[model samples]
Target: MSSLDKRGLKERLTAGENVLVAEGYLFEFERRGYLKAGAFVPEVVLKHPDLVRSLHEEFVHAGSDVVLAFTYYGHREKMRLIGKEDLLEPLNVGALRIAREVADKTGTLMAGNICNTTIFQRGDKEAVAKTRAMFKEQIEWAVQEGADFIVAETFSELGEAKVALEAIKEYGKGLPAVVTLAPQATDKTYDGVPMGEACRQLEEGGADVVGLNCHRGPKTILPLMTEVRRACKGPIACLPVPYRTFEECATMQSLKDPITGRREFPVDLPAHLCSRTEIGEFARACRAMGVQYAGLCCGNSSHFMRVLAEGYGRSPPSSKYSPDMSQHYVFGSDPSFKKYYQEGLIETVSLNNKV
Candidate 1:
């Protein structure tokens, strides 16, 4: 069995291997009430290092190939929101330390994670710079603390993603950067960029791996991955939010304004999420469609990650045609059934049974 290491993950994929990447600790912690809102990084690492390591170990026990640090939104800016800005360095750096502990234990690759600086100003250079700074600090800490790769995820716009990619290149120094976007269920980003076009832009911006994550469930994102598989040349990842199918919610959020094109709150979301078997099926289908990195987004659980890991790279079960279905043609059960006849069956008139 080949142990996981992020630095060589792309090479392995290029050599025709399907890698299983699992990321889900924050939501798990939150669901358990160990983590309050806006304090995942600090609470998990500083206060409850055992919980962080325990979650990582759960993924390892379940067969995840990567230990993505629960450093999502661990920058100083987000810390300031919850009045924990003073804990920024300890939170960010300490998260990486916790990640390393797990990666070392399980021999999994540690992926440095950063997402959504909350500065999505497209044309404003100052705003973009601030976003870069936010990512830069986290990327620097991850690199210094020895992460194998970087994942910039849940981005809703190409412009903000570009800024993140630039920071990864600047600070990570050749570490593979996987940029994942959160497009609406309509297959376009909330900022109005088509999913395919956004993947292309991230590729051009120097992201080593490009794919979709968060927002939509795997069932709804399947067609979107099919669309992206055409535009993206090499390996791609597809880690969807662990929600039930998007049939309940047409999109991840409410309608956007006609003028500003924004929906502040997500009014529609599934009360229950996908089952372990369904997530496994999702991983299987993504592998068939050429998605190399298969994982879960928010609401991720150890059981679901195990489902994905169990099915990664395995061929889906061959389709079956029901024997009864074939009998329909011969027995004249089908209105247009004319291909064959059943020897013992009688095709008769209604009154006299004359055929």
Candidate 2:
């Protein structure tokens, strides 16, 4: 609609080329915490245009190839929760316009952002259908306004993700679509579906690339990629958040505890922090495992992605060591054979090293 080639973007994405995408808050809510009610008031965006612009520039400078518009909660229903449903199109268009301007100047791609519903309630077919329609309307608008791609990110269940894929096919038609899932504690969807199953569902439902983003940190999701790889045939993109462990949260609570017989006051700690180098390591591992696209999510910035791109071009991990050597070394001894083997051993040191 805006002279952008939707089919071309789909081709590129399906081919497994690298694409950098960025996402952050446009409103002034609790910084780096999970989304809650009253978190996306319109006034926050009006007051923080400069902050949004600065972040866009930061990501572009850090070698990002794409910048996603800050319209994760820009749907009509989510806005109605805050009594601003009328501002849906305006807010969504404004964020895209701003991101497009920055991306145009930096020669980066711009993707339209679509997040999960406000409440993650599963098994509601009607609600899921409604969300799908709203998402289709929003994505069509974004494409008309010139978005290079559409990212349905942080989805919590396979059913919801399936609806999103259907919407993309119906409205987006030919635009590239990337669907990212957020897993619960056991690395399964909130609805108890495995990550591999989710990936398969997304791919079968018409997603160009199936991946994971938000929810957990890099360290936790890195090990799960093997399963994801086995499940889907398409390219994988991993955008992990830098999260604080439960231990760290408990430690902070203890430090803020009061000594007297009074109520426990809430502690206001800074957002969880992560180093670019650590994120780079995660990206490198993904690349080594044949991941074609890589980026950062919550608690991560553009610098994190730049390190990732740099790390992707470096050498891969070595596989010279035998996989069973550790197990052999740990359970190699047989007490019954000690007397029998001692007489046959030419050198006792060689037997010790072998065991």
Candidate 3:
């Protein structure tokens, strides 16, 4: 399929099509040497370019329609911690180079991605200005490198998302922008803003697509997307964390005790990771609700992207999967009826003959 431009992308989503974007760079970032979120910015871009390229290739092969550059933490604050503060431009450029190469090779859209730097406070003029400057710098590099869109994601506050979108408009040079928050099942950002209000504010702030990503599974976030759809008029996207037991933990970030606030890590989180069937099923649900962008956030592997694409890309009335028939076949269609009816007849005849 041909890649869509900004208007084309929005149009396709309006038509109930899934714009599958690969958003879980943290998974591969850990697989390399960067064990934590803070260490990934410099290491992945400067020390290990090969791993980034390989991951991008894997994402494209796994059916990602859009490949976001590994700019998730490419800001100066994150880099200054490692004394690679001067390498800010290099890191952002290097990461985008790898993503651009793979995207160009595979014919996928390349998105410039940035996330929140700190907890957002609305009245903090200095902090907001600084954050916007950081975003502007990143957006400049992304635009210079020929990115198709800019995604300001994983914000805990609505104000940060609004700042990112404004920065995109200032430096993105007319590229489409996507702003996604990290919301909980309570329909609120970790910073205490309502999710619907978040989407509405971003839509008013000039975001082309407004939605949420990470911190929970599709099962938990599906209902929340309804509120997002109501607030966001253009296009809505949801990329839940690839976790399973949403009942136990509504979001990966809140893996702490509710009362004690004790956190757990390296503590058998696989139980929270969704199976391939679960991810695909989530994608199917997104399509039904008119969600144009179906993506993943944390714990996302290539297999997860593949499954999501397969499920969301299926034609209407045939999106469900069944072991007895091809996934492309519609449920309860003539072919399915014949297959089951013939099997039933054969079983009845065999039983009667044996008796």
Give one digit per residue, the lDDT tens place, for model 2 in 240-316.
Answer: 66543233222212222234533221212223445656766777788778776677675455555567666766211
**Weakest ten-residue segment in model 1 by summed lDDT:** 314-323
- Cα deviation in Å at residue 75, candidate 3? 0.9
Candidate 2 lands at a TM-score of 0.74
lDDT string, candidate 3, 18-117, tens digits: 6888877866577444646535554567777888888888877777778789988778878787777889998899988888997877777888888987
Q: Write the per-residue lDDT of candidate 1 for residues 271-337, one digit (tens) a residue.
A: 4467767887887788789888888887787767766776774321111211245446665466554
A best-first ranking of the candidates according to their lDDT comes to: 3, 1, 2
Model 3 TM-score?
0.81
Q: Give candidate 2 regions above 4 Å deviation.
A: 1-8, 11-16, 26-44, 119-122, 244-272, 314-355
**Each prediction's Cα lDDT score?**
0.76, 0.66, 0.77
Task: Output the number of the TM-score-best candidate.
Answer: 3
Backbone atom clashes (below 3 Å) for every candidate: 0, 0, 2
Using all chains and alpha carbons, the TM-scores for the candidates as numbered come to 0.81, 0.74, 0.81
Top-scoring candidate (lDDT):
3
> Which is the better candidate, 2 or 3, if ranked by TM-score?
3
Cα lDDT over the full model 2: 0.66
Clash-forming residue pairs, model 1: none
lDDT of 1: 0.76
